[model samples]
Target: MGTLRDLQFALQLKIEELRQRDTLIDELELELDTKDELIRRLQEELDRYRTTVSLPGPSVVSAAASAQIEDKQRAARQTVISEPFIPDAATLAMGSHKSCDKNQKSSRLIKAAFLKNDLLNLNEEEVRAIAACMYHTTINQGCFVLQEGSIGDRAYVLEEGRLDVTKDGQKMRSVEPGDMFGELALLYDCTQTYSVSAQTDSKLWVIDRKSYQTVLMQCGLSHQAHSVELLRGLSFLQSMPEDVIMKLSDHMKECNYTDGSYIIRQGDTGDTFYIISKGQVTVTEKKPGREESIVLSELCERQWFGEKALWGDDIRTVNVIAVGEVTCLIIDRETFKDIIDGLVSDSCEEVQKSNASKIKPDEDPFLVSSTLSDFQIIDTLEVGEFGHIDLVQLKSNIKHIFAMRVLAKKLILHNSQREHIRREGRILMEAYSPFIVRLYKVFWDVEHLYFLTEACLGGDLSDLLKDKGNLDEYCTRFYTACVVEALAFLHCRGVVYRDVKPENVILDEHGYAKLIGSRCMKKVEVGKRTWTFCGTVGYMAPEIILNKGHSISADLWSLGVFVFELLSGGLPFDDCDQMKIPTTTIHGIDRIEFPEIISKDACALIHTLCRSNPLERLGSSRNGAKDIQKHEWFEGFNWDRLCNKTIPPPVIPKVQYPLESSACALYGEGSVKQCMNWDDF
Candidate 1:
């Protein structure tokens, strides 16, 4: 009976222990279930992240729609704490919507900045109009916004991220949000002075030049009229009527001068006239035999100077220095002349109407006082195939020198040739370049066409080459650079100068190269080829020789030959017999041998330029003259000084004033014929 009782107690104990084990197992199962639920939630979150990362940003929305998107984004952000932070489909949509809203806000900021920009001087309505015209663009990091020396067709206002600005490989500064760039393009056609690249993903508001200019014209008419009124307030310009003043205002450019800066030196040639808008300037005259400059006068605000320089005298008689920081409205010589011409024409018309006897009806009232009457021929400079050039001087109070080219109609055999000569005159009259001869006037008599051009007394390159058998590298580079610039300017204007030889390049008194001989020049559209069998034999490119369509590439080829001849003192393909020259040139540079004296870079440049295929030529590249200018041979060359005629030439020609017969004979033989009266055209 006692053993049975003990066994029953042990059974009860075992049952209790089993019951406790069952409870512990149930707890473990519950924990596993919770963990599985958490893992499922984590996987869902990961999937959402992948979706968000892969999805594209929202497209641009209208302003009204953007407001609704912003509200949804706000609501989505508010619900973040209440729900899982994972960006699910709803959250992803809100994120994209937020980006669209951000863009809208950025655009608004850009518009605000434009409104506040002092340079633009825009009114509220004008700002709104310009803002409406602006288009938004986003640039990726490490991408360029503007490149230096590139045509700046659009202005940009940064609304997000930063940009790095550089000039000539040197860091200039950083452009941050709210800053504007390429604004000058809005005012006129200009090249970007600095390169701007994105440092981060950036958003910008861009306004193209055409749109900007349109807005400016619409909004700035009153401002322009105000400027005209300001000009009319000045004593010197007081004589100008409202119409003339309005015309003058269009051509004026505002410039600033710092304290102690020289505006114009006494000896420098002046091509600009200035009217002080602010500050003062001191006009000092150089006292003869004295080191100290004498202060002639002081000009203050509303006063003007440099008027005398525009009367074709050119030379600045006084040194004008800024007394303090000064602002001036300046007009260039070309614009000033145009204004004067208009005024003269109006005056002449009025006078003729009032007194018919003073001006004949058949006579051209514009030519009443002929340019010929102002000039007195001193001596003949050259006798060419169809024309003669003479040294002439202005008989006016201010003596100015010029070279008058006379083309005899009888000498030109073909009517086309006569038209070409006329075209040359027109080209000379219209072309205003430092590298080309400046034409003052063009008129024709019954027998001859007259071209009164700026005299270049230093003679031609052929003479220089003859006197000094071979030129040094520096000399060759200088002259070649000038020609390159001249060609670039002509090419830009669609003019192809088929002839670019040493004989055609005339050196001025300053030893700057002036391109002449426009007979072979033809205006062709860019990328279009001409098939004229023209130009000198040895200098001609293969395409020209074979009568294959040729363009500006021919000029570049001639430039190579010119450089070779200049450096080597002999033509690259010159043969004893003249006929063999064509065959040699047509065969390409295989027969050509470079001298030991020629640098490797120069030889390379020549090879590239003289390639059998015109397309492979150096300057023929899309960059055009810039490619040639940036060549290795031209490395370290001061192109600015070359263009400005500031670089000292290797050889300065020994030219005398009022040249004698011997000096004149250097070009060729010609006579100054007084065939027509001064009044008769």
Candidate 2:
């Protein structure tokens, strides 16, 4: 019933949204009609002026005169596009082995030498920092820089002399000075497929995976924040999706200009965009026959120009010169073109609203209308300390199956969980979404309280993950999307879901994930906070763990942990070195090293959502879940299909029917003496 109601509500919302859009379109059309009149008058005036003044060429009027360009950049810094420490995982077969302290190398690095390694895509400052972290080492002649089939921990840059890369003792390639080798090992623990040996007494620079990824993540976070913040402030791109903005930011490069250096010169053919990030830059135009340029305007930090390059206007008409030392976030046209296709066109909710029956195929079974006596107990699904959840079948219709949560009233009273149980029951009864389990009905007797809900024969994500080890990106994405929908549904109703994890997600007959019953959710109004310090360790957000008042952002943080764990098979904050980990805060999440197995895109999403500051989390902005849904990682995802259940789930399970049994018979009305406290149910 809840699902049915929410679908109806969703339809109403979609209709309203479309109505608003239609009104906006009408208003825009009216504006265009006015603009057309102005254009006709201007054209007449232009024709008169052209005949009088003898214009340079024949007159032409283009239809594109009123169309606005997609004023955004298409370039990222070539030196550091993303996760520069590792190559594209799909391109390389990876292996890693740990090396002891004795195997670690140290040697002198030539400060004056220019490093020529394709593997390191970093600016001069990053390169220098990496160089400092790299210990100098020497390999004796004929010594293996790495042995075939041996696991390794560090990557090396050839500083002096040379080495041989061989397979089966046959030289396959030569390692020259400034070349990088064994770089993949720095990302993960894997065995070498081949061998590298010093052809001479060679000097090498070595940096481990931990050091390299840490430095890059630190720089990437700061750079990502600055670029994204700058992009977010621009007005023309304001309506662009957040994911596209993040994509542009990732591909954007930082360029520096000293006094009088030209960022973009007049009359030069250019397709690059720039955002002034530091100091000031003077925009100037060189008039015809003028020796010196006239200053048009000055742009400072957070200001941008040159977006015309993203469109067809590739020629720079004016020079942008640095007033002093100026920094810019720049992107080229090709990058913009590559990422612009990801722009979200329209909401598909309207299509869903058009469906005649906006309800799941499995509508409410007769059990919701029937009394308790019409259902017979099948078997106990889970035996908890409070009571047990049992599978049940409708006596009148054996085909209908459901799960009954039978909690002992006495136990709930003793545990002081009556209010929590009441809240959960109320939420489950009121909430509705395809991503959330539908609670059919609530009942109470002298001994136990019962919560009848939809039975998910496919089991839960926790069990599925246990059986499959860990999910691939495809499965992880699907599950994360489902969870996000569930959380969004709950959060929109002013509910703060503090418990968000795989164990709470169950897959239904169609294998689509749904958030089941939750006890930790609270009805927090807008801008309100809850002080309850409850959540699973490692999965809880920093605010919850610190007893800091929290809102829905905590759920988003846990969603980050859910995504990270599903992809990498472990919690981000969890590690063997417990002492080294801080207890008060998770502010050092930037320092956590993600396995190379997780894609850079996935890591980027996780980082944004898992920020220490709740307000800074990706979805915590005013746009909420739309920020996360439009993340670049979820590009091309069909949210409408997910809502409509038209998309097949990542996993499907064989359905199992529980046979009728008497296990729940012992927990009937006469079983307990203390049931007076649960009268509300």
lDDT against the true structure, per candidate, is 0.68, 0.69
TM-score, every prediction: 0.43, 0.47
Clashing pairs in 1: none
RMSD of 2: 28.0
Could you give candidate 1's per-residue lDDT for residues 599-635 as a string of tens digits? Answer: 8998998988898877668876435688999999999
CA lDDT, candidate 2, residue 53: 64
Query: How well does candidate 1 score on lDDT at residue 629?
Result: 92
lDDT of 2 by residue, 1-681 (tens): 235644554465356556746755764664565455445545544654564666344332332332222111101100000111223333211211222232312222322232443323345655554566666566667666677766566788787898999989888999887677876554344457788988887877778766655554444445667888999898878887776786677568778889999889999999999998898989999999999999999889999999999887988999998999998988888767756653432133324433522443454646435766667766557655456677788867677788888777766664456666777777776676778888877767776788788888788887777678789999999999999998877776668877787878898888999988766766875434555545555677776543335688888888988998899777777634331122422554687888998998999999898887786788875456899999989999999998889998888888877555333232343432322233455
Cα lDDT over the full model 2: 0.69
Worst 10 residues of 2 by lDDT: 72-81
